[model samples]
Target: MTPSRVIGYVRLSRESADSTSIVRQRQIIQSTADSRGWDLVDVVEDIDVSASKRRLDRPGLSRVRAMIAGEEVEAVLVWKLDRLARSVVDFGTLLDEGINVVSCTEPLDTTSAMGRAMAEVLQVFAVLEARTIGDRLRSSIAYRVGQGDRWRGGPTPYGYRSVRHESGDGKTLEIDPSEAAYIRQAAEIVLAGGSLYSAMQAIREAGSKPRRAEAWSISSLRVVLTGDSALGRQSRHGVPIRDEAGVLVAPWEPILTVEESERLRAILAPRPLTETRRKASRLLSGLLVCETCGSRLRVNSRRTAGAQVESYGCRANGDGRVCERPASVNADQVETFLVDEFLAVVGALPVVERREVIRDVAGIAEVEEAIRHVTDSMREPGADLGALVAQLGTLTESRDALASRPAEPTIEVVESGETYAERWARSGVDERRAVLESVLTGPVPVKAIGRGYRRMDAERVAAPWAWLDEAAADFVDPYWTD
Candidate 1:
């Protein structure tokens, strides 16, 4: 009688770290096949793939399934049952296909009823172990985050480079002055109303290169501009991580101030489809609101009697819910009016920079180090537990006191010495928009004017900036002045 044909499957979680794992599994499968008097057709492999997490998309496993479906093999051989699948749902899927799975080290023989029952029990424990390992890893990362340790896992950010920590076990980010200079230049260009491609040109001129690609692209430049790493803040999955004190957790010195970061984000934010396609070329594209339908005013251009007239009209006119009296005004006139109004209001106010003050109080770093020393000493064999306990208590008290202290952040007001009119000449649309947004609480309402009225009406445009109180001066950040 001919021996049954069987295929061997192997998987390794980390291919580079565990070179011997694949070899070991292959040897076990070959030896088992010889002992069982089965014809070993071929061995398939999936390197650096985890069984518990990436179970469905394994190429080698797909080949095994194809062979089983084609009746090319009577049985599938693995070093262990978990190597086939860590989850019951995955293993049950294979069992329901009526394919016999034989494990070299485990008693997972899908042909027998008792063996199938045993396989289910073992799969449950495998899933539990995978989850427990995941939990421990997440807990370890959380502890590190709380301790203000930078994660050295992924690629280092553009403006920063990884360096060995002073204590020497882990890595920390340090501002690379050469690369960081380019970040500053790029931000300045964007803030000054220059395009991202223009910033890319500036970065290239400074002899700075991007991290991954050979040359910098606009998208990559935008990523660097908007990343939390530029603000010296730690983030996971695009969300900033805050400490227990509610302050953003910063491990390294900042490349950009919080105000600069906020302004860059605002400037680089995506415009609406209508604005982008038609190009909001005007300064007040999204800022104007129709008083009738409460919709934003979008720029519209029409050639009336051989002259191309650009105007800002109610967007609701095209959105199926037409405004009863759609507001329309010449684009150039309304922008000029709003700018003049904004400048007349708070444009001369000295922009105050509000920043969180940082101080090293109560020797918190020293206290934490002392606590770590005491905790380590307590773990030593035949150590003095009583003395170590006393030291730890004293260190903990000092640390708590430092943490509990309320942070007194003072507003630093720096006078730019330049009035609004003087800075307005040097500013771009983005800078002007930032200024307008800081003064106005919401969209400015534009009431409809009489048809064919060529004269610009100041009454038609409502100024939210004029209504703002003096206390609103707190919202202003030095833009063109800086």
Candidate 2:
């Protein structure tokens, strides 16, 4: 007799305290699999993801669907029916796919009429529970807003902190500073017809780092300038709300003055939708160059017969140049090749060597020490101090000028290994992007080949030398091979 094919599915809502904690879900699924005498083929888990019955953002659910479509699995086991789905529509669709679902804790079996009815009822309850939780959160937020309290959640925007402030009841809520000097500078640059990129550079030149140790980017600076707290206001759905309206209010401490806020807003208010399209086009677009014309390749995406296809092509040949290259290369294929090759390259290096290299290069304390020494030298008094001060002022002016400019194009390497993966998991997307840029040297080149496929021309660019690179490559090469 063949063993029953079973795949365990687990989903946790981001709002739930234990939604994505693997230990709890794994224990429950493992116990159930042990009792049922079913062969567990795979375990799909998505963390900090929502179980929206009306939505399909759950990665675990998508995995399950793929398993069923490929006929790779016969049945799916879940801790409960709610684990499988929270929406009646999604539940019905899953049943239609003919994959049996078993809820270990609930009397949910898709095989029988009574079981199906019970599953529907359970789904209704789950949806209701999800809605109730959402409503409660919103209500709590509204209540806090009515009291003129700010919700201090997520990372505090750059140049701001969640600090205790005196409330009417003598409790404290987090607020920004009265003269958000960095924020004001950012606004001034933007209003003076400076680009957002330049404004961020200016902020950095002024020796201003984010509340976190990370350098500021245009996106981060934009978030700060447009943030409700920066404007000394509170907002919900982009609409400014008053405390009396029972909407969540930002803790009132003026950062940028009203005039500054208005000026920044004016700069951001108008844009052709094409600007966004152009930006989307340029993500990783700069990584590829036409071998013939040496022009950067452009990315184009379109839907064909319910499937979307993306390709990179030479923009220079649009006017009818005899370019031997194909019109485009498959973007998916290009990405997959790059990712696979990149991973292979990474895996080829010894973990210890990589760590040592990272440790040697990422000497944050050393950089800080250099900054301190420079600062100290500027502060000391002597006859030569006057001349030194002038030099220091010139350096400061240069640094500030550089800071106010947009960042130059650069490639960064992201350290990989168990430790690096753990840190990446905890980091925000922007933070991760910054870390990647810091360690990798780039102008990552892509070459289009046959049938809309592209390969990364790894030879064209050099990898950033970490401390490990400083050591003899011969010593590291032998260990890596062994």
Candidate 3:
């Protein structure tokens, strides 16, 4: 008789600490198939997948099912029955589907009444064992957290890696030197009053790779800078775990101190959106205004003789309003004139950096809400009282910490030791735009000038400084005339 065609299935759960390896399972299944004179067509596996997962959640299992449904295989062989399905419901579903499942270790003759009964009993025991293991694991994790141990089970925070503890009992997080240096530089950039976007650019230029993504995302960078893990504080689900005395439990080395982390968080906190649309990438985006219709001029570019030439014009605004006598100016000419006039007017002024020391009270209400949730859960049946009590202690500590902070903001201004001109020379476009906003009350209005003016007509521009100078001249002229 021709050997029966069969396909072998194997699975290894992520939490199965003592489960058989995929290689061992494959060896057993292959040996069993050889002994039974079966033609083993293929061996499909789901590694690091839970056996309790539904069929749709397991790609390898789904493939096996599809093959069986197509009648391409006579029997599906496995190293053991539990590796195929951990729950009796799943096992019974497979039986009801008339799947000829053959376990290498636990052979079941499902045609016999006694065989079906034994299979059901074995499946029941498998489910019970899975739940028991899950409970034990949860208890172990909770005990570890309570004892001031950081959980390194999942992905370690950026700039850190899990290493075996000195006692060889479990894993502990240690700073990866290369990645930590990048983090330190990033923190310095942020603390020095630089935007997160600037820090991201610096990291990318230095060839620093993030933990997962090809480059750092704004959200990921914020987490790296402001996360409790950066300050060596243990936390779960973004809430810091506190000890019995309401102090945060930190057991590993830190990339930043508590003060530095707080300051970074303050600087990076979300602010209300403003109507300002001038990006740092553009030099004169929000500065120039059309003299005719008072609409902000937009940058327009054209390819001229194998080169791109940019100009600012107020042809039409977004509201469908077009200037009857639209004004246009060369970008380079206007930029140069503005920079020169700006520096000649206020270049000697000193640059002062203003820093705001803000106390974060945004998450206080959130902590209180979480405390209420945990309290409500305690009244429910089968609630883990020990775990819930521990959680409450941490939440209370967080609330106390937030409540102790002063509500008023403290402002500090220090000299940057650079003149306006000196800073302008070294600053980016966005920085220059900020300087213009500080000195000017509103957009600089440009008079309607025809195209092809090689030099910037100083009379055609009505900058704030020019207006002030002209007013002073008029005041002195009236006195001289009388």
Candidate 4:
């Protein structure tokens, strides 16, 4: 007589499960199929996968479900019902679909009413066992974490090495200073007003190893700086199982301080991953700010004199009522100024400075200018120029207030192996912008005074940090303001 075709399904939740276990399950399933005069049309095996994951995420289980849904097999045979699903509800869903289930280890089968009832009861037991095992595992880990014990298994996070426990029971993670240096540098860069992109450059300049091959990359540094691992916290499957109060469950020391890690998190929380910048044509493309109106100076290009010309311009002052700054500064002209100014200021500093430079240039006036500019537009203009006159008065107040404020403290930079000129020449646009950003207070405000309009003067170019610290303030009265 011909045998009925069936689908053989096997699952060993852990990939580390012994091969003999799989052979035994297959053998038992085959033996039962033969005795029942059934032939397995196809055998599906899920190795190293867990019922803990969703069924769709598991390839073998998904294939088996699809097979069953299509009614391609007369019956589903497994070593045990738990091999199919740890959840009884999931198993019941199969029975509800009018598909027959048979387990080689259990005496349960869907062939008869009594057998079907036994199968469901066995599934219920299987689910209960699975849940009990999960609970016990969670409890064990929580206890281990609460006790401040090291992780017994698994890979340690980057920047840390693991050593066997003193008792030889497990392993503890220890900080690897060489690797830790890179992580600390990343955190400091972000805290110093540098973006993740800047961190990538600094790592490259430091000759630090990247998680990826060759030079450093954003995704690599991102996981380190923006994760709890940097804070000496441990996790698995990207999930935080327990906080375990008062316990520092990390077997290794962290690369960043608790405060530094918190600051990075706060800064990173609101910003989307898409915030990474793409390559731009000019060096200071988005870095330029209008000290006058508090608007970012945009790089606008136009076709003039039969060639493409690019310059930085402000949109708010298009009406020419709010700002006293220049209408537009030449792109090549500004970049030359930045490169020259960068060399003058940063060039004199030591070649290799400290691991981190402090960023203290305040944009208080710039921020206030931004707010005032927006608020001034709230009122409807009168038939006359009253609103305009009122807004102009507000702009003058901002300008005068900013002028009266004391000089901002200079950004102190230590020597890094290379001079600013060398680094600037070697770096890309984003990196150059980062170096410029770390030192400059806000945007390079361009004031058009008969003040050497021909040559971009540094004094008129208002940088928060001096080009070389008080070179006889050369423009107004004895202050020699430009």
Candidate 5:
């Protein structure tokens, strides 16, 4: 028989730093090929890609598939069966394609029934191990979260620099003053009613750049305004949550002050009616229920002179008594109600207190350096993996110990609502709106109340500036406010 043409395939997940190093995998493949007197046809590698247990996404696997389809290779070599595939379906497909697989490190060969059984068993173990790894990672993140530590592994948000704190015992992460100043300024701009575009321009004019050369955008400004973490609050799976007593809490250093944060929230709160109309126009235009024939309502833009008005009405208006509410109500009136109701709820919040809670949480960053130091030690070369794991265990224990420590409670109160009002006064329109939306309830709901009026429900609205409904009732015009 001609010398078996052996092709090597390797794959690694992005989350792992050293799963499939090209040099290492290539060395193993070359060594195995040399020992077996096999001709190495090619080496294919997939870096930073996941091998789904049910589906393989490895580029190397794809190349192997192509080679098999083209009848170019006799056998495929892999570091292990798990590296080749985790799914039985994929394994079956590979077998059906008439390409044999050999594991250099394991006694696995697809040619024999016994070897195939072994491959199946190995695949089961691989899937189990992948799930175990995922669980462990989630547990690690949850543990860090419980300790009020930032779990998302990436650079700090813009307008803030991750600083290392070193002391006699260990190190931690803190906020860099220079970058934080920019964060504070951004918050101020939002609270002042500045537009997101203008605010971005202002940031650029002030020589402000995101941590990774990212361009400033309205969405980015909205993220900053709504990010409780910047104010030293913890965001659990993207939703901001409060402490035991419904108070904002942080897992790391705060980039903005409580006052500034509250002000920003007030500025970004949503206008329910206007938001509803906009969304309805886009998604539910002809799909809305008529409440009469139960038929879908067709959206209509009633125009007077040069201005256009929008509303939803029955699709069959001339269907006689079958249609219940055939007349159109002013969309503007409904939008106004929503805006007022949303603002009212948001303005009722104690923004200053919430900000202080965030501040206290940020103080925990003083311990982040210690955590990082330990984390780094565990990742060192030739390091005892077990010892590093033990160190992580110890760090977790220490964190719990610190959290259990008791402290005196002293309330720091702001003078009045005027505090935020003054801040808002200083903010630009766009910035103010961004701040408002960040703290407002997700979206306002509008229901038909009476002719030319609608009931707006914003019971879920939770912004520091919700109290502003009373102060700015006339400013409820969504389209003209900006």
Candidate 6:
């Protein structure tokens, strides 16, 4: 004489909506089970999910079906018929398996013919109600957006955070100060002529990450940097959605100015990949900039008396008369001078200045990344080599261009009185590279002294940072020449 087993089910479309709350629905089903003397198996609930979708759409509904199929329950109980299903087809399928259906709130049960008729009639109203609600919600959001209202829900975009007021009007958007700093730095780096790749590296070096991704990815950075969001304008589906007066409405202050945004956009804009660049054969390839023609110094290795001597040659000489600067500097000589200069000065700078140097290092990394990207594009299948060459000409020019010279940082603190040189001498390749890059922009230029012998002198090396500059020329990049 065991009581008949039954499983209860409930659904609440909106978490805040009070008409059909989970607690209320559970009370009704539990009471119904108590009165009918049916052994309650379990209560399945779909929170904040609409009943208008297919039965398969509701995880709770699917769970209930499996429970009944496993003979865990012989009947299903719900606060209302629509809670189980809004469609009459789904309504029939719920009872198709010979499991009786009961609606506690509705004056109906599947055991009687008249009850089935009333249940179907109630389903029509339920479906109509759900559709009406969905339509109203859509119109309301569209109206709010048209009115230039702030987006009310969803995660905050990059460089922003959600701010909730105590008055409970709902959360508003605000610039996340620390995260916003990265965005500002990005715009500055690019405005000062750094690429998106450089911006990404700078951001990571500065210790900021995007909201979603682990590290600054190319695709993610493109979406964040190129959009109107950088200007603080609200966007929908990745594009800035305009307001009634045709103005871009932003809930929070913009991270970048309009001019800055446009400049960034121009820099980020798509270009034809035509620079026929081969993979870097040397560690310092594309990092070195020529003071004469401002062209990239390509890596060249030649045999001299059965020993190989590596040198960085002017682009003009390598590519059939592109530059008047045929001068090549010994690679080892330049690298050692630059590294020595970095170790001597960088570690003694103020911690804050050290941090700035790291950011610039990231910027340098970004420029190198841009070069790699351009090189990759030119090598893609069916690339227009001629067109790509022209495009690469511009992109690679920007990539090889040196950042502004860093000021001579006054030395203050010395840990254990150890010079940066001592630390460099003891450090590994990776540590040495980081230390060097953090202080001076890469590929120390060894301009020939008086255009005489190709004597690689430390006094002739020009670094963006004062730490590496043996001679402070503060020279601007000469116009890219043939």
Best by lDDT: 1
Model 4 agreement with the true structure over 156-226: per-residue lDDT tens digits: 67787888768776566778888898888778667755678888888878888765468777777777787
lDDT per model, in order?
Answer: 0.78, 0.60, 0.77, 0.67, 0.59, 0.66
Q: How many clashes in each candidate?
A: 0, 9, 1, 15, 38, 11
Off by over 4 Å in 5: 1-3, 15-20, 87-99, 149-155, 158-173, 251-253, 257-482
Give candidate 3's error at residue 24 in angstroms. 4.3
Arranged by TM-score with the best first, the candidates are 3, 4, 1, 6, 5, 2
lDDT of 2 at 336: 56
**Which regions of candidate 1 fall more than 4 Å away from where they truly are?**
1-3, 17-20, 149-154, 167-171, 204-209, 276-482
- Candidate 3's error at 333, in angstroms? 1.3
- TM-score to native of every candidate shown: 0.56, 0.48, 0.63, 0.59, 0.51, 0.54
Superposition TM-score, candidate 6 onto the true structure: 0.54
- Give the 10-residue window scoring lowest on summed lDDT in candidate 4: 473-482
Predicted candidate 3 versus true structure: per-residue lDDT over 1-482, tens digit per residue? 12389899988876366766888999999999999898999999988887765643689988888888898987788888888898888888887876767778885645456767888888898889989998998887776676565453667888888887777667778888889999998898777656798888889899998878998877889889988878676776567775543345668788887667778888898775874654434588878888899988889889999999998888665568967777788888888888898788667877666667676585575467567777887999999899889988988998999999888888766676767777676456766776676666578898886556565766777777533654445321100000
Model 2: how far residue 453 lies from native, Å: 59
Residue-level error in angstroms, candidate 2, position 165 = 6.1
The reply for model 6, stretches above 4 Å from the true place, is: 1-3, 12-28, 45-49, 53-55, 67-72, 92-99, 149-156, 160-179, 190-221, 235-239, 242-253, 266-278, 281-334, 338-482
lDDT of 6 by residue, 16-100 (tens): 7446478888998899899988899899878888777545478988888888788888778988887788886777777676556
Ordered list by lDDT, greatest first: 1, 3, 4, 6, 2, 5
Across 89-199, the per-residue lDDT of candidate 2 in tens digits comes to 888888888767878789987666787788888998988998898899878666655665554244454445555445544233334443278778778657645578877
Model 1 accuracy (lDDT, Cα): 0.78
Residue-by-residue lDDT tens digits, candidate 5, 13-44: 56355454667778898899899899899989
